[model samples]
Target: MVTKKAPSAQTAVDVALAELVEGERRWAAIPLSGRRALLDQVRALTGRHAQRWVDAAAGIKGLAPSSPLIGEEWLSGPYVFAAGLGALSATLEVLERGESPLDKARFGRAGDRVTVDVLPTSPFDMLLLNGFSAEVWLRRGVSPAAAKANAGLAQREPSRTNGVGAVLGAGNITSIAPLDVLYELIAHNRVVALKLNPITDPLLPVLADILAPLVEVGAVRLLTGGAEVGGYLVEHNSVDHVHMTGSARTHDAIVWGTGATAAERKLAGTPKLTKPVTSELGGVSPTIVLPGQWSAADIAFQAEHVATQRLHNGGYNCVAAQAVIVAADWAQKDEFLAALRAALAQAPARHAYYPGSDDRVAQAAEAYPRAERLGPTGERLLITGITPSPAEPLLAEESFAPVLGVVELPGTGAEFTAAAATTANEAFAGTLGVNIIAAPATITELGSAFDELVENLRYGTVAINAWTGVGYLTPTAAWGAYPGHTIADVQSGIGVVHNAWLIDRVERTVVRGPFRPAPRALLHGEFALSPKPPWFVGNKTAANTGRLLAGFGADPGWLRLPAIFASALRG
Candidate 1:
């Protein structure tokens, strides 16, 4: 008997790409029903391994299984992924019936651009995410009729041919990789070669189990390694297209070869990677605070909201609130800052898990030495009085850590909003997302002007009284940067993902939520039943609520609603 040697990493890459080439040939020919069945199988597998998946992620992130922070893993990991599967399954069902998913979609006008209501898509959405709503704004000149016809074009066409696509996963977010795979397969009708980030190597086993449905069929191939393997897959001749969820640095490195010559390549409008590329990149996301007559309760609640926006996942999110813009003359500026500081201090301290997070936090501290270090361990940083200048490090860079910067502008009401929007558009490093926090009275007073303000701000997602992460989690809503980005200057990278409805000509997603929770919302005349969201850092019952939500997402049914509501109410 002779000893056998396993194939090397390079050989594995070659084999995976070769297999995906064949898978892509058959993927387009598979009817809608067959694809739907594959999705259903994956959803079931996700439910079966949901707990193990959450546990593994928690362990990697320094969260004990019993720790409340473990909720972050459950929600961001399996819950959102499961929800995406459910959304895609529903879309497939509609397509199989030879009907448009947008047939019943409500359309409205936003500054001459047509907007389609995407959230609260079903009665279940209403009950689950009660006060939350999202709208997909179409590109200029895209009529509602055109949007309806263009929705799910790949699925509608019978002669569509597909090819192999590569997904370079994000290290920070667990669901980004799988969700990107889902979008590539369903939305683009392509087979995928998913390369997990090195930091997420621990998840390889669980993902292999959960994604076995597609892996077994060769429609998807999961690989593990670092940049060398990733570069190999990206440069593979057989891979037709590539999509990535990471930083612009990584995107640029792949598109234009890194080194001193990379700049010259970018300037010359030439890319080393000839294949079409789509990416979701991070940026300095802003949370614009409009001057308004706010009560103390309003100040406290919104402060926590802002803190959660910045500190969720220990501030590793691409949409994390990097800067909070406020009016310098606002009377309650001090009060709001104090409240926000308290909120930051109250959140439990966790390890800086992501690679280079310590250096990033230290860089923010070094730049702004006077920045306040809050929280138990003093790792949470809050820098104040930052000027909106290109020279400002925080303004020009994505911190990707537990760091928040405050910039105060001189104005009131619409004037402040317009200035802040302009600064956010010009000063921020990327156009991934921005948030606006305005009181109800202020919005009512501004009316159409407020809509105009939101319309003019150039971000993939403009969230009002909500974190842009809500838009990312809403599978029906498109997620990416503002359009018109060329291959040379990929700000937040090009193209959109997680758009289950597959509506094209998308400009951005607008997500709005209640400013207050439950009883307080009722007092504010906002008819919303949701309690503190599970993603909140201080939600006591977050672990329980997130677990229940995961179960609900895995297999949605009326029977699961009560338990979910019960856990959420306590949170």
Candidate 2:
């Protein structure tokens, strides 16, 4: 096996800290307008290099050039970043004015606003926009107080004690490192030294070039390496706040040192001294399919829904629906499973990106000896009859593969909802996103129960009808659920990512899409063969829409309606 190696600790720390100081100094001197201009440059450059970026990422992931995953990575991925730019542009405008609509608030005295700015569009925007909204709502509606806090954080000098941030990036997603750095720099007004996970080190230079504006502003710096490099950066003296999007084990090792040190901390009831750290770790997200409400079409639509969530990016996502909790007594249970099996069987087995994934599947099989295997890669879409043992690894652990285990419960809508909620709350993982699929009438009838169930879910984001992954792509939806967690209990993660406007957040977001099929949609089965046909809503279409939406976003007038209809019709 060829294990990717990280940079030496001494070199990693020296380069990282030096870059940090330089970035902080440069960022402090740059005006907000200059920052916005730089961001505009990035947006322009991203458009120019869109194809190259998509191709490079697809190549690394071993995806076919014409694969739907390519379109997804290209269209959905970059589009999310573009939306981030729009949000950041709006935010910068507020910062430049030194006073926003937030100043008229009844509570909290407004201070002389300092203008701190960083790169605008990137995946971080998706994290920030959602995080801000969730945080605002958690604090009880959209209050000017939270907005002011966000603005205040943005304006603070990066060299300040609370302003230096260390971001440890994940290997799977090419955009994760940049997004992580962007969030800390733009949202929190922090100078960032990002440590790249070794798995994706080959893309570091390309990522660096793409994020050059932030690097030029000294707001962001990229460091590459493995365990030692990560440890050195996280434990560095200058680093005040830290964030990571990786495994729970990595988090624990960082928060409470490994081996004897970890044991000592556990026994002492207090961790060894450390600065604040936040993360968005992995999870075994669950999707609950309500009984009796779904028709055969509904079952098929939802089967694809769950399949897309699980198969997207080869099931490496933290929010990938890992478990399906359904009503055992539902008349259509078997039919639904059969359809799901067929749908999954059709999906080409993805490259098992993470190491030891096969072993994880083996472990799951050991727990559920009767698990059904699927696909040519031994990538079993395991179906487990509800097992009596809660200690079973299939039920307790995150398999992090294409494998899914089904647990059945006896109930209709309300009963199933309650049971699913209980299962989600009691699950060992802290970071989770629950998805519930039911008919419109069923939703209306059991609105309160559904709401209660959603509220009771411990996961960060609860998606209804749509895939929870949609929440990650939508700038308006928050990503991570658990906050204030260090690498120690990084169940899902500590803080939010992809939020563009950098609002303090609480709770997960609920993404709701249309229940039935849309005839003209790219995601429809009819369009599956060519989801990214020339007219689809992707990078190229995005450029066309950007020109149209700029006018619409600035002024929503009926004059733009024709263009909007044209775009929709073309798709």
Candidate 3:
């Protein structure tokens, strides 16, 4: 038997804190242009070292080098960092200029000044859905009063006395933790130190090199170790702010403590100490298939949608759709399931992490013993029959595998909408990305209710007719939901990431995709050869998209026709 050793608590904390201090000083001193240049360099470095990074990441995660998923990660992961750079640059421009135009059509003239519209992108069919929007007050001359008002709206300043940031990287996804670090440093303008989970230790050297510019400039740093290190870092006196992307149980333990400490804290109605820790704990995100919207083709399209969300990264994602909330009266439920099963049957199984994954799946199987199983080595794609209790562990708890739970509610239009809203609001984990698939008719019929649901959903990202995970990679979409009570009440983390354009954000983001066919579908394993793609696998895709968008910018109608056609045809 092979034995694993945990790092000493003191050693881990020391290393993490040292990095944090360095990152803080560096971020505070660096000029915006220098920061931008470093980001650009990192983007170039990512492309140059793409294969090496992928290999290192795959080796550590125990993934096959040739796996399509690995290819996706290699291409889409780094682009998120590049997108972050772009967003940071835009933010800086807005900061320096006092106002930057985002969308022209949404702008209306208020006397001489322009009123910019920050309406989030809404699905074409579901215009009634409440979308998040932020208003940017702009004028030719800088108004001190307006600036003061805008400054007051800022969440927290970088100079706050209690400034501290800790990042806990995900064990399965190599890019997540580092991205979180980037958000804290650039988005929130905070000092940050990242603690690497043991499973992803091999990539630490690569991450160190990739982030060396930030380190050399003192904007970021990385630390490696296990539970002791994590515990010490979270509990350290100097660490005031923290963020983690991992299990909800882990977040609970850190905030509430565990064992004797937890019991004491509970009895006393107080935690060990109050630190503002934020976490992107896992969620059992749901996809609501509204009736009347899906055809055989639509069902097939969405089957790939659900399958891609679950099968991506072997279903280790926090925002991966774990449950499909369908209307009981929907005629195409069985048809959609058939296509979903077929798609899942073809997906490769991932390496089961930690020892209990198999056990967890087995436990889930007992509730719906007939559920189909898929990969991880003859892994079955388990689907539970329609049940009365949608709040069962299979639906509520994070399965962390290819297993999906199905729940049917009796209703067609508004009734169906109400049930989905209730379920998503009450039964889901703290953080979620709720996906609602509605036909044009269904959307029209329940437009008001859908809007209400979108606003009421506790999730961070509520996607319409698309998988919610895409929000993570979209440069315009903010990653975090909203601020929670405290470190203890952190439901889906405190901040956002992957928004390279760094605009003023609302509470949640709503991503609109076509109900029938999207321009690029990375979920169906189709992006392998397509020019347009949505794979969150690597950061290269962002650069490609940026370049393509920039080219399109150069020529709106004529020169970019090929690129536009390629994007649509590729889908």
Candidate 4:
């Protein structure tokens, strides 16, 4: 099928910027009912081409035709679109019923801050996410009363001018760009001008198809090009808000000048671009493993959990675990490490699809001269035991590759968790994702101590016994770093996204998972979940499993359950 070629970069930018000028008004004027109907249409359109999207993304990345790694494409591609649309649909449904955005959500107050249980919005969410739950903790001084009063900011302040939002798309995740656009539209009530990352341009046609309804309504405009085009768009006078999914370096370059000029400006607390820029930048995210007694099976399961955190998407995710923080005095540290090595060894590695991955891997090696590169037996290196340079690159830069490091802290038990939190907060430069893998007993033992530790972690999304990306997939769970970011040194960018609840004041989200995998033989249990959850690169039937799961979510019926269950079992 011959497709219409994208216009020249300059022309694309001109067209996008102009379209956004009108689109923002049109979008803001669109009622919740209209938005709901359009989103329903978009969901159907997205569901129609899930397979072609997976195939195109997978094949272009050099993944084998039958490779389970294609699951990454399906999950990050169609599944996210379907899930995000469902979330938006639900929010619109609430508005249609003349209720607040989080009307049914249970809100709790802890001292001055407000806590909202946003996930598991329905019994179906509980069933879909068995053994998993998520909650959003509002920023300090945000009382539940204030939250309740200003719950639906977008809907309440519809006449307010949000102008236009320009989203600099991430090349890796196929869902990221559109998902970010959705946040800007539904949460901020702004029209979006999305510049597709040049690397993922092959998926642009697919994206255009998925977003056709919005595009037709003049609510979204797609542009494509390298840095030059992005540079032009960011500096475009009409662009009011900027949201990007890339490195901090890219953020700085866009908000400030490049090289010495940028450094000087950063030091002076000055920025070249003075806009409300929001970004989900890279970070040195660490997964803390608390010292605890564990059954052999539990050890194996958590090991896979850790491995999946690092090896997912070949560890290219901004939220992927870059370092493993283990308790130094733990008796089973070596046992868990061995199990992790074995799990990684069993998992297959694909090409480092992202550009500059090799350089990033080399940078990690340079940081720890004695580091040994471990692997999943393919064209990749999982760097282990990197000397921690808290202020420098290894422990600061986001290594967007299948590279990981292990650090064993001297602190143990609650002390260990506190120390790990300190390291994650003080050492890592970005606050996008944080993971803590503690046994249920450890959490219970720590009690309020664990809650305090979580409160201090300083990430947009925090997960226990699960990858931080779980927060990314949680629609109601806001996805982005904690607030208070400056353009000079935007750690994980400014502002947040994936906040389907339309909560204006968000601090962080906590997603909890089971310590062990669900039972293998049956579909129903205490921990029923999507097989290997498409994020796992090792699941052989991930593509089919993800498609079935996506289809089920888009148009769920009892008939689809059996096929989804069967495919999930295959994985």
Top TM-score: which candidate number?
A: 1
TM-scores for all candidates? 0.98, 0.82, 0.80, 0.93
Q: CA RMSD for every model?
A: 1.2, 7.3, 7.3, 3.1
Q: Write the per-residue lDDT of candidate 1 for residues 87-163, one digit (tens) a residue.
A: 88888888889888898899998888999999999899999999999999999999988998888857776338578
Q: Return whichever of 1 and 3 wins on TM-score.
A: 1
True lDDT of residue 563, candidate 4: 75
- For model 4, the superposed segments whose C-alpha errors exceed 4 Å read 1-8, 109-112, 159-161, 376-389, 520-534
Candidates 2 and 3 compared by TM-score, better number: 2
Worst 10 residues of 1 by lDDT: 153-162
Stronger candidate by lDDT (1 vs 4):
1
Put down candidate 3 lDDT per residue, 1-571, tens digits, no spaces.
9988876667666766776676566566566556667766665565555556667766765667555455445534554455445555555544445543242225433333333333343231022112223322233343433333343122223343235578888887667887787677766677777888887888877788877777776666677778777878777877877788887677778777789878678567697647766667767778888778455666766677777777677677787777788877877777877887776776555576544667777777787767776654656455756453446776667878767877878887777788888887667665657787776556777767777766666666777765675566555556765445355455566656655444443345566555544323334322222332334222223323433433332222355545644443433
- Backbone clashes for every candidate come to 0, 24, 24, 0
* Residue runs of model 3 more than 4 Å from their true location after superposition: 1-9, 12-16, 19-23, 98-162, 353-355, 375-378, 386-391, 482-490, 498-505, 518-571
The 10-residue segment of model 4 with minimum total lDDT is 521-530
- Per-residue error at 235 for model 3, in Å? 2.3
Give the per-residue lDDT of model 4 (tens digit) for 1-571.
9999967878878877888787767776777788888899888888897877887788668888777777777777888778888887887787767777766679876445788997778766766666688889899888777776677667665556488888999988888988998888877888888998988888888888878999988888998889998888988988888889999988888988799998888788788888878889968888889888988877887788888888787777888888888887999999998888787777776778788887777766666666556664433455555545676556767878877778778867678878888888887778888898887778889987888888888888899877888888877888898788877668887888887777878988888876666573133233445344556656668878777777865776667767766776666
Q: In terms of TM-score, which candidate is stronger, 1 or 2? A: 1
**Which window of 10 residues has the lowest lDDT sum in candidate 3?**
124-133
